[model samples]
Target: MRFDKYNKKTRAETEKEMIGCLIVITCALVYLGYETEWGTIRL
Candidate 1:
């Protein structure tokens, strides 16, 4: 499926988008992990 925002993207551009998404997700997870006080763990 096309990303609605973009009519077309090259394979290289698509791969770059995927990599960028993963990096953003990984950083967010790490930040949350640090922000959490694991003492008895409460969400």
Candidate 2:
């Protein structure tokens, strides 16, 4: 029973970290999309 509880806690912590990383990456992509002048320039 004790081992099961520890496993659950570890799994939750890993999931939280993954979510935080995904959010950070998503924000970075959005910021880059708006920061560049790709749409305003002509070829």
Candidate 3:
């Protein structure tokens, strides 16, 4: 029973970390896209 509880807690933490990483990656992609668009307009 204790092991099961610990496993569940670990899974939840892992999921939260994964979600945070995905959000960061999405923001980075958006920033890069905007940068490229501006660069093209300037050229």
All candidates' TM-scores?
0.59, 0.56, 0.55
Q: Can you list the residue pairs that collide in candidate 2?
A: none
Model 3 pairs whose backbones collide: none
lDDT (C-alpha, whole model) for all candidates: 0.72, 0.68, 0.67
Maximum-lDDT candidate = 1
Clashing pairs in 1: none
lDDT of 2 by residue, 1-43 (tens): 2446557567668778889999998787776664456562222
Best by TM-score: 1
Which tens-of-lDDT digit does each residue in 1-43 have in candidate 3?
A: 2446557567668778889999998787776664554462211
Whole-model lDDT for model 2 versus the true structure? 0.68
Tell me the deviation in Å of residue 32 in model 3. 0.4
lDDT of 1: 0.72
Report clashes for each candidate as comma-separated counts. 0, 0, 0
RMSD of each: 5.9, 8.4, 7.6
> What local lDDT does model 2 show for residue 42?
24
> Can you tell me which runs of candidate 3 are displaced by over 4 Å?
1-9, 34-43
